[model samples]
Target: MTIDHFFQAAKIEGFQSPYDTIHLKIFYPARMPSQVEINREILPVDLEKAPFPVVIFFNGFNCDAQQYQWLAVKLAEHGLVVILFNWIAEVMPGIISLTPGIDVEKRKPTIYRTVPTASALPALLAKVEQLQSEGILAGMLDLQRIILGGHSAGGRVAIENADPDFFPQIAASFGYGLHTMATLSLGYEADTILPLPDSLPLLLMGGTCDGIIANSCDRYGISPGNATTPVIRTFQEAITGGRNDSYLLLLEGANHFSINQPDSTLKTPLLDFPATQPQESFRLLMGEIINLFIDTHVRHQPEASQSLEQLLNTPNPLIKSFERK
Candidate 1:
């Protein structure tokens, strides 16, 4: 956990699949090179921090990977590898970019905005192999240490696909503004509330002022606002394996898009309904907590266990609520 490494991103164009050519924008710790890639000032990957853990992420609906660069770079500076992909809404590109499992109906996932593609782990793992062969991150990726994480609906996909039997390499799963509460469209009596992930260690987070979940009532038919704290509730009631490794957190004055940058009104979305706290302030606290989870659960650091408990239990200006099962 030091931010001594300078991070940089590189783009790699094609990993063929039935859905689309899966493109990636990877963020990793790098060193300035004297002879950089032609037009762009691409630097060489930092071999000093070789075999770093990987974080393959999914973004919220109507959002692109670039919006999450703030979080990606934060993780990268701490010597982790972060990967994001090129995705589109197909019809409107930026207006309604859709992601898989984001629009599940009757417990069956749908293709919203006409992309006709799924953001499953298979496609992403294929790309990681391609990145290795292409020499961008050659011999530097640690397959044994991986985490699948996302935001909002993108978070839903991460939770759904975290299968230990299938993707054994993924050590943990996390989602900010995400939960497994069954929805009306998913054939559950509206807001049936608690259906937790049993496969992976999960980190579910939300904000008190998260207006997005309220707005989501129409599409998914889950409980609105604080009628019940579904995020914390899901973590509380979860059974064996997932329960032992899970954590629930609520940010005091944050919003759905707090993990995103406050760089521009254009870059962030109006659908978020305005975040109460400064995004960076929120993410500074977010990054520290996220790293703790990754370091403890994913990397299996024995020392981090004590620090994680103390940080969550102690008083802090940023944290509003905390629970662990």
Candidate 2:
């Protein structure tokens, strides 16, 4: 599937997810020079301050990291270190863009059937260490407060690989338009869902009208509208509800590409509903909701749960449904 997306991207400058794909882009809160905005400048690490929470985001299938810079900026603006990356593999001899070079094509399972997505963490940490060594982000990161997140396929990689028992530094895991349902090739069975890490805090976001998940069902020879509510079921089934709290947030009138704009023309929304809200509005609300989740899980703020409860219990036009467990 990864190679299939690449071939589509190679045909056009803007097909699938092509161009400006960075293997790594780390955003941090820092003093901007004279008049430049936050993301416009990237130096003078705020070493005197306390350790900043870290967030590493993986990209969706064939999705580039550049498009999510807005999100990185949003999170970093709130004093978090956000790292965006891709799982670029050397599929053919000479094709490479946006992939983090992790050789995920083999699709081999590690101990207990987990994919090799965890392999990307070491490289990510190494880069963080390099930045600190150069005094770029020195003393500004707390690896112990790490949160792993992603969208769609990338989100699955994060949730599946985030093992706090194995990698205690990870504080939590989150996903947007993500699920753990295996395709036919991956041996998915009825009523079976991928297991999440032990006692891991989770946040799963979904859309009531996520046409991409529904429309893409044909790839596995399944019906088009089968997976319209897969994220909700994923949350109900995968969450190991003890020691850590988990949440499910379904947005009203949202689609698969709601977190960010449709980056490529290849995105087929034939099965999606007309977006009731603008993408900008969707992202602003998403940023605030993510802030609450991170504050509750990673920052250990008991007060954050109050805001979350308000959103979950009170009726809202933005959220179709909200539940906690």
Q: Estimate the TM-score of every prediction.
A: 0.80, 0.80
**Global fold similarity of model 2 (TM-score):** 0.80
CA shift at 164, candidate 2, in angstroms?
A: 2.0
List pairs with backbone clashes in candidate 1.
none
lDDT of each: 0.67, 0.67
Model 2: CA > 4 A from native: 1-22, 33-41, 46-49, 86-115, 218-223, 267-273
Candidate 1 displacement at residue 91 in angstroms:
8.4
Error of 1 at 314 (Å): 2.1
Candidate 1 local accuracy as lDDT? 0.67
Model 1 agreement with the true structure over 1-325: per-residue lDDT tens digits: 3222222232223323333443467888876655445344456777776788999888776566777877888888878888876554332333444343233432433422233123345767776676666666777888877888889878767765666665777788788887656656545566555443466787878887776765666544654455126666666654345346777889888888888754354533555556666778888888888888888888778787778888899998888888776
RMSD of each: 5.3, 7.4
Consecutive 10-residue window with the lowest summed lDDT within model 2? 1-10
Task: Give the range where candidate 1 is weakest over 10 consecutive residues by summed lDDT.
Answer: 3-12
